[model samples]
Target chain A: MEKFDKLTGIAAPLDLINVDTDMIIPKQFLKTIKRSGLGVNLFDEMRYDDDRNEIPDFVLNKPQYRDAQIIVAGDNFGCGSSREHAPWAIKDFGISCVIAPSFADIFYNNCFKNGILPIALPQEQINVLMKDAQKGSNARMEIDLEAQTITTSDGEVFTFDVDAFKKHCLMNGLDDIGLTMEKAASIDTFEAAAAQSRPWV
Target chain B: MSPKTLYDKIWDAHVAHEAEDGTCLLYIDRHLVHEVTSPQAFEGLRMAGRKVHAPDKTIAVPDHNVPTTLDRANAATMTEDSRIQVEALDKNAKDFGIHYYPVSDVRQGIVHIVGPEQGWTLPGMTVVCGDSHTATHGAFGSLAHGIGTSEVEHVLATQTLIQRKGKNMKVEITGKLAPGVTAKDITLSVIGKTGTAGGTGYVIEYCGEAIRDLSMEGRMTVCNMAIEGGARAGLIAPDEKTFAYVMGRPHAPKGAQWEAAMNWWKTLYSDDDAHWDKVVTIKGEDIAPVVTWGTSPEDVLPITANVPAADSFTGGKVDAAKRSLEYMGLTAGMPLSDIKIDTVFIGSCTNGRIEDLRAAAAILKGKKIKDGMRAMVVPGSGLVRAQAEEEGLADIFIEAGFEWRMAGCSMCLAMNPDQLAPGERCAATSNRNFEGRQGRGGRTHLMSPAMAAAAAVTGHLTDVRDLM
Candidate 1:
């Protein structure tokens, strides 16, 4: 897993709520187990038209927001169907931070796992960020994972709270299993004790 | 001293050890696997030359990539690419000696459904899966949750997981649910009120008079949305209802063991004096037939409510809602009843159960789907599909011009050629309606199964109560 220090890029405003897994990476793309290669088809249906051509009206196709690395979206940004692929595709597409009023449970955790910073902000704060995001793709926003703050180009700072344990894991790139391995010695001791008592090993 | 909550009791019993970082090593009793995420984990195991530590505790099934209609017949006819993926899962499970319910097995369906139906999800167990809906097993008073592929491999090699403790949230429903209201409605209303992320970093314990009245299936539906509300898991106290639901299943205890297990399960509840980190209350009568007007699940209102105006919210929320309405081709202040639909889908893990099907069938009997509207009924599991057929509900759907298809996650995510055409709008029973959740540029209106059926007959978002 890559380490996250800071993310500064163009802000793209999807402005839609409940943007679910299917829209992030349609079900057909789920045929393969490989997590990579899905970014190209992220939002495939909306990104293209009946002729499979880029729909110029879609937010992703707007020339100014084409290279957006930060997504400022509406509330409940990743709801419906628990597919980790949604975060995987978003991360692979170069989106490192997602600022929303809320996110679906699974997709929010998956974002942290995949090195994306999903910031859950109050609706009032999110409104400001979304406006900043609409200033075209070049409207650069900065996110400092260490400081746990997001700043806009206009010098506005927003601080959000994260779970202490999750924050530790993200800072050190430790997942559940990685956290376990950190205590490999203690686990070995317990296994040895259980084996001796039961003689099943 | 703190009185024991159901979560505390379960967590204490399952703890194998506590690490230096304060994360506990949990002993997992069951691990469920599916085709989409398990292959990489299996490969990781083989690379390390490791054998499964407890094959009997693990089970595998194929669902996500398998075509719902031909899951049985076309198990061998998969595209060359998918064929290899499916074959890899089969071989991996075989080599590890884990129980594999392949497509050919009559028992095959969604992994979560198969586990509980087969009695593998018993009380006092900790279940893990690579799929998030794994929380469905918590209906049995177990600690069930989704894990990543790496953790899947780790559990395969060692049936244990490192988990951080979460705060306890008690969501109590105080009043009786009115007739025509179901567990789906309650959960949808909760999501709408809680803003989808309301339960983050907590284990939600459902209680109160209304929750106790719900059947085990209804309880499962409530817990199923725990993930949607940002909770690690949701649980109900184990009572006679929980015990009766599990007794006599193939995987459940029998004889003296059954009696002993029952005694243990009886103690799995929060004491009268137990304290919770957070408590939220909702009156059942306040909930209505919820329908998502925007892309998010939280973007919902009662079926009779109008689309929210842009000025209703502060900041850019108004503009964002406006943009979503434009993409969805809906106008502000338009009555939800005025939105016409091109398709209707009534199935998924969320609402694809026997009761959900029965609900839909009741509304569709002797009724015809409106012209120019296509409706599809996909059961969540093969077992559900068979039971619906046996109950003659399939006939009602077919007679109503709705497609009666085999079971899998069909049209839920637009996988397996089941998708809405670009710009098409659908009234879907499944969980979401994000932009293109059904297909590219496809618009979705999330509703209950019965509501979806009503929309199919009306060609518009009509309240199910109106049809009732």
Candidate 2:
């Protein structure tokens, strides 16, 4: 897992509600076994036309937003599907932070697992960030995970809350499997008790 | 001691270790695996050189990316992408020593269908799958939910999941269902009232006369849409019907073990007066046969309603409704029954059980689908397909001009070859109505089996009761 800390990069505005996982990478692109190399197919249908030509009107396809590392999106972003590929594609596309009014629980957790910061702010705060993001490449937002704040290009700053343990893991690049393994003895005890109590399982 | 909700009891029973921060290492009793989301998780396992923690607890099948036709056995006939994904699952299962149902195996089908059918998903257990619809098994009184690939690999490696407690919600359905209304209608109506994201941060427990009256299959149908309602899982208290459905299954306990299991399962319901974060009551009589008219599952209306104007939605919803209307090709004020469809899909983890097949067949018996309409019934599993055939339901579908096909998650998703072409409109028995869910530019209207049959026979969205 990649460690997430303070990052300064261009932010893009995608003001659409219910931007589901299928819209992020679509089911067709989900066939890949490897997590790498999915950035090119991120938002495939929305970014491409019938002829596979780039649709310039789409936010990610726009000239200045092409290299966006942060996304200021609408409410309930990543609403459908438990596909981790959604966050995999987002990170692969160089976006490390997503600011939304709210998010579906699964997608929000998956984002943290993939080292993509999903910040749920009030819609008004999201509106502020969305406006700053529309300032093209010049609007580079600085997110300080340690400080728990996002600073816009114009010096406006907003604080966001994240779970303490999840925040610790993100800052340290701690792999969850490795962290869980440290408690293997406890797991073994639980399993033994479960086996004796419910032998059929 | 405080009374615990159904979700709280199941969640507490599975907690292996809890940190002061409220994060708990949840013990997972069952892990359902599939082709698409799992390949990367298995690869992660191989990359890390970690062995599976409990191979026997895991089960695998290929469904999403496989062709539902006879050519499934011939990999050459499938798209390269689809073939590779399915092939990868076969290898992963073998390498991990997991119980598997290969594509060529008659037992093979959608993972969720296979799990409950095998009794691998039981009451008082914690079930996790790589797919969102794993919530289907919660009908058995388990705490089941979907996990991402990272968590999939975590479960494979540790047999435990990291989870925090979610709020508890009670959706109480009162009154007996009206004639012709089904569990699918009840679920769709629930989502329609709650809207998408209404169940976020809550594990919803469904109870009441209407819910308890449903058969095991009907309960599964309602629980299957929990994800679409933005809840990670949904639960129904186990009863004699649930026990009867599980008894004598391939993986179910027998003899003394069965008695012990039942003793615990009988206590799976929420205690009377258990505290609830939220409580929603729905009168079953008010739930008419419904269908989704827009992209989101929440954009549903009773069969008799007209297309809602975008302006009818307020706040951030207005633009979403407008976009959905544009994408679905629906005109404001248009009667829902007047909408025409190019296809009728009767399958998916959501509505592909044998009971679902029988419901559709009842309507199509001694009748034919509309002229120029194409309809297909892809059962949830191979066993479901066989049972439908044995019951003469398949014959009814075939005689009615509906294609009776092999089982898999056929047209509910576009990954399979059974897909809608661009600009095609469909009346689907599947859960999702998201744009391009069946295929690119494909518009889906979610409904029950009988409702889908009605649309098929009438060449439009006719109320199933009208046909009756």
lDDT of each: 0.80, 0.92
The alpha-carbon deviation from the true structure for residue B235 of candidate 2, after best TM-score superposition, in angstroms, is: 0.4
Measured against the native two-chain assembly using Cα atoms, what DockQ does each of the candidate structures obtain, in the order listed?
0.33, 0.82
Q: What interface RMSD, in Å and to 1 decimal, does model 1 have?
A: 4.3
Q: What is the TM-score of chain B alone in each candidate?
A: 0.96, 0.99
Q: Which regions of candidate 1 deviate over 4 angstroms?
A: A4-20, A43-82, A95-105, A115-201, B70-72, B75-82
lDDT of 1 by residue, B193-301 (tens): 7766688778888898899999888888888778767776888887888888888887887886777677778888898888799898999878788788887666789
Q: At residue A70, what lDDT does model 1 achieve?
A: 89
Q: Which candidate is the best by TM-score?
A: 2
TM of each candidate vs. truth? 0.87, 0.99
What value does the lDDT take at residue A97 in candidate 1?
A: 85
lDDT of 2 by residue, A46-142 (tens): 8998899999899999999999999999988998899999999999999999999999999999999999999999989998999999999988999
Instruction: Tell me the docking grade of candidate 1.
Output: acceptable
Q: State the lDDT of candidate 2 residue by residue for B234-285, as single tens digits.
A: 9999999999999999999999999999888898889898999999999988
As for candidate 1, its clashing pairs are A17-B295, A17-B296, A18-B295, A18-B296, A45-B440
Q: In angstroms, how far off is B302's CA in candidate 1?
A: 2.7
